[model samples]
Every structure is written in structure tokens, then in C-alpha cells.
Target: MLIGYARVSTLEQREDLQVDALKAAGCDRWYVDHASGAKASRPELDRMFEVLRPGDVVVVWKLDRLGRSVQHLVDVMVRLQGMGVGFRSLTEQMDTTTPGGVLVFNVFAAMAQFERDLIRERTNAGLKAARARGRVGGRRRKLGSSDEAMIRQLYDSGSVTVQEIAGRFGVSRGTIYRTIARTSKG
Candidate 1:
């Protein structure tokens, strides 16, 4: 049996075209997910998976209808293959039941991976250059040096509790404790 899957990113969008394609491809029944491609989980997709059998073939209007990313698509393909289930993407004209289809899918996956690697490499290089110029990442400290000194004084005077100091500085009690601990260390 060929089980079809369709997807649209929002409630406002329709899966009419996908449904038509699935039907034309001779799908026995179909599932539709009204969710973003970025989401890792979708109710209809999960439900469809529950009913898949060894000899079943999963059909989709397009590969993107089935997964959020290339990695996700590959993972789904692997799972389907393990279950002896075939995959057919009408738009891509690829079928995991055939050798050429599998080769093309693997090539696409490789390109996606290479693109991700290049993005990561460029980001790392940019960060390295910024660090060389004495620029740093992450949030700035909530408490300045003067504020730390004041917190330490207030903590040592025993006039205020750590909670009271935290309230005064608009920070957490942990920050107050750390400020006092820094005084001991210095």
C-alpha cells in the first residue's frame, strides 16, 4: 500500500495540491500535517508512522513535505528502510525502492551537510576575528564593580541578609553570595 503524506506550514494554507498529487500517484490513503517545516514533531506524521507496515510505501508530494531538514529527511529515510518501507516523492520523482533514487537522495543529503559545514566554518572564523580584537560574546555582568563592592560591604556589615542585598541590587541571592566570595578570594 502507498500511504501519502502532505504538509502545509500554517492553518491558513491548504494541502490541496499535495493531496491531488498523492492521489494521482495512486496513494491508498493520505495524512496531512498543518505545521511548520522547522518543527521536529507533527501529529499526523507520527500517526502515519504508527500504521506503517513492512511492505508499505510512503508517498509525498515533495520530500520537504516529509521532513524539517536534510538531516531529518535522511533519518526518516533510514528508519523507513530499516522497516522495509519504501519512500516515493512525486515532485522529486525519486523512489527509495530503486538504486538511482537512493543515489540522488544521498547526493542531496551530502550537499546539505557540506553547506552546513561551510556555514559553521565561516561563523567560527568570524568569532575568532572578533575575539582577536578583544571583543567577547555572551551577556554582560548584571552587577558592575561598584555594585559588587557595595554588595560585599552590605554583606559584611551584617546589617542586611543576602536576600535583602539581592533585592537591593535587583539580582539573585547567588549573585550576592558570589560577590561576597570574590571579596574573600581577592
Candidate 2:
């Protein structure tokens, strides 16, 4: 079964072009969504997925109409392939049910993975350089060295409850406990 999916960015925009293309391409049934490509929620798209069978092919007027980005497209393709379903982009003339389309989709998946790996490598390198310069990556310390003395004094006196000390210090009881432990260690 050939199932079509068409989308327009807004409710005001008509899906005439995509709808016509899908019909001409011999789509058995179609779904349309008045939602932005970047949106994760598309009710009609979700419905289409529920009705899809093993041999059903999902057809879109263009590749962009189906995904927010190349990576997103690759992810959707991977999911479809896993379900034993195929994908077709009319504008791109790509059909995953065909040999050439399979080759092209594989290349796309590879490229997306390569791009993600490169991004991860660059981020790691940047963090390493920052660490070498004595910069840290985590959240800033809530308590300073100067506060340790007063915290210890209050804790040793045992007049203030741990919860009260935490409230005064604007931190969690865990922070108060850690503070007392560190001071005791010193």
C-alpha cells in the first residue's frame, strides 16, 4: 500500500501541491497536517503510522516535507526500515523499495552519523581545552570556603536543626550534611 503524507507550515496554507503530487504518484490513501516541519507532534502523521503495514510505503511530496532536518529524515527512515516498510520522496525521485533508493538512503544515514560524530569530537576537544585553562564545566558552587566555619559552628552547637541550617543557607539538607562532613575531615 502507498500511503502519502503532506504538510503545510500553517493552517492558512493549502496542501494542494503536495496532495496533487501524491495523488498523481498513485498514493492509495493520504494524510495531511497543518503543522511546521520542526514540530514533533503531527496528529495525522501519527495516525498514518498506526495504519501502516509491513509492505506499505510512505510517500511525501519532498524530503523536507517529511523531516525537520537530514538527521531527522535518516532517523525516520531507520524506523521505517526496521518496521519492514519503505519510503518514497516524489520530488527527489527516491524510493526505498528500489535498489538505487536503498543505496542513496544508506549514504544519507552514513553522512548523518559522520556529522554527529564530528560534532561530538569537536565538543570534547573544546571541553578539554577549557579544562586545561582551569575552567570547569559544571554548576557553580553554592557555598564558599568562608561559609564552612559558620556552618560548622552552627552544627557543633546543635541548637539549629539540619533543615533549619539548610533553610538559612538556602541549600538542601544534603549540602548541610556534606559541609559538616568536610569540616570534620579537615
Candidate 3:
């Protein structure tokens, strides 16, 4: 059985093109997901996996329709293989059932991993450089020095409770405690 999977980034986008292609490729059943590929939870995709049986070939109009990233695609392929199922991408002309197709897919997966590693290395290097330049990366402080001083004075004077101060400043009690800790540290 050739089971098809079609996807679109949003509900507004049409899956007609992908569905038509899958039909042309002789898919007997279909699973359609109308959500962003970046989303981790895809109900339709999950359902498709549940219905997959041994000797079934999972077909997609394009490789991207099946996975958001190379690692994800490779993982899915490995899972299908483990279950004695096959994978095919119409646009990429890939069929895991064949030796040459398997070789090409492995090469592509390796390249994708390499690319991801390069990106991670570059990002870490860039972040380190920025830190060296005294450019710390994180959210900006919500409370200022004066606010901290006032909080301390109110707490020390015993005129206001922690919850009262937090409510006045529209911040959580944890934020107030953190502010005190930060002020004490400095």
C-alpha cells in the first residue's frame, strides 16, 4: 500500500497541489496536516504512523511535506525501516526500497547533520564573541535600581509586606525576592 502524507503551513494554505501529486503517484490512502512544520505535535502525521503496516510505502509530494528538518526526516525513515515499511518522496525521486535511493538518502542526511553542526558552532562562537564585548544576552531587568532601593527600604522599615510590595510593583513575590538578592549581591 502506498500511503500519502500532505501538509500545508497554515489552515489557509491549500493542500490541493500536494494531494494531487500524491494521487498521481498512486497513493491509496492519505494523511493531511494543516499546520506549521515547525510544530512538534502533528496529529495527522501521528495517526498516519499508527495506521502504517509492514510493507507499506509512505509517500509524500515533497520531502519537506514529511519533515521540518533533515534530522527529523532521518529519524522518521529509520523508524519506518525498523517497522519493515518503506519511504518515498515524489519530488526527490527517493525510494528507500532501492539500494541507490538508500545511498542517496544517507548522503543527504549526513550533509544535513553537517550543516546543522556548522550552524551550531557558528552561533556559539558568535555568542562568545558578544559576551567578550560585554554584550550579555537575556531579558532586560524589569525593575530599576531606585525600585530595588525603595523595596529594600519598605521591607526594612517593616511598613509593607513582600506581597504588598509585589502587588504595588505589579511583579511576583519571586521577582521581589530576586530583586533583593540582586541588590544584596551588588
Candidate 4:
């Protein structure tokens, strides 16, 4: 079974070209979506996946119609391959059912992984440098010295509950407890 998927970035855009190409490629079933590729949710795409069975090949008019980026394309291809389904892009002449297509897809998958690794390494290095400069990556501290002192005083007075302190400071009760723990440890 050759399933077709056609998409347009906006409602104003027409999917006629893609649909025609997919039909020409001998697609037995069709799924269409009119949404941005950047969006993660696509009801038609999800439905297509649900209807896909082993040995079914998913055909798209173009590679970009199926994924937002190379990484995303690789991920979707890998998932389809794992499920014993194949993929074909009419414009790109990519057919994962062929040996040559498998080789090309493997290279693409490797490149995507390499790109992700490079990004991860750079991010880690940046965070390390920031930490060396006495800067940390996270939300800004919501409580100041005065707030901490007031919270401590309130807790010690035995007249205020943890929830009350948290409400007054606009933080969670767990945060108040952790603050008290840190102060006691210091």
C-alpha cells in the first residue's frame, strides 16, 4: 500500500500540486493537512500514521512536506523504518525501499546526529563558561535576603504555616522548606 501525505503551510496555500504528484506516484490512500510544518500537531498526519501497516510505504510530494527540518525528517524516517514501513519522496527521488535509497538515508541520519551532537557540545561549553563567570542558567531567584529572613522569622514564631509563608512570597511550600533547610545547613 502506498499512502500519500500532502500539506500546505497556510490555509491560503493550495495542495493541488502535491496532491496531483502523490496521485501520480500511485498512492492508494491520501492524507492532507493545511498547517505550518513547524507545528508539532497535525491531525491528518497522525491519522495517516494510525492507518499505516507493515510494508506500507508513505509517499510525499516533497521531503519538506513531511518534516520541518532534516533532523525531524530523519526521526520520522527512522520511526517508519522501525515499524517495517517505507518512505518515498517524489520530488527528491528518495525511496527507502531501495538499497541506494537506504544508503542515502543512512548518510542523512548520520549527518543529523552529528549536527545534534555538535549543538549539544557547544551548549555545554557555553554553560560551563557562564558558570565560571558566576552565572547560572535557570529562573531568577524569587526570594531576596529580606524575604528569607521574614520567612525564617515567621516559621520560628510558630504562628504561620508553610503554606501561608509560600502564599505571602508567591512560591511553593516545597521552596519554603528547601530555603529553611539551606539556611539551617549554613
What are the per-model numbers of colliding residue pairs?
A: 0, 0, 0, 0
Better of 3 and 4 by lDDT: 4
Model 1 quality (TM-score): 0.82
After superposition of all CA atoms, the RMSD between model 2 and the true structure is 2.7
Q: Which 10 consecutive positions of candidate 4 have the poorest summed lDDT?
A: 177-186
For candidate 2, lDDT tens digit of each residue in 1-186? 999999999989999999999999999899999999998768998898889889999999999999998899998899899889999999999999999999999999999999999999999999999999999999987999888789999999989999999999999999999899988945
In model 1, the runs with Cα more than 4 Å from the true position are: 155-164, 173-183
Per-candidate TM-scores read 0.82, 0.82, 0.79, 0.92
Candidate 4 matches the true fold with a TM-score of 0.92
Model 4 spans > 4 angstroms off: none
Q: What is candidate 2's CA lDDT for residue 42?
A: 87
Q: Pick the candidate with the highest lDDT.
A: 2
**Native-to-model Cα distance after best TM-score fit, residue 60 in candidate 3, in Å:** 0.7
Root-mean-square deviation of every model: 2.6, 2.7, 2.9, 1.7
lDDT score for residue 121 of model 4: 100
**What's the lDDT of the predicted structure labeled candidate 1?**
0.90
Q: Residue 29 of candidate 4: its Cα lDDT?
A: 83
Model 3 earns a TM-score of 0.79
> Model 3: per-residue lDDT, tens digit, 1-186?
999999999889999999999999999999999988987679999999999999999999999988888888888888898899999999989999999889987897798889899999999999999999999999998889899999988777788999999999999999999888877735
Q: 155 in model 1: Cα distance from truth in Å?
A: 4.1
Alpha-carbon lDDT of model 3: 0.91
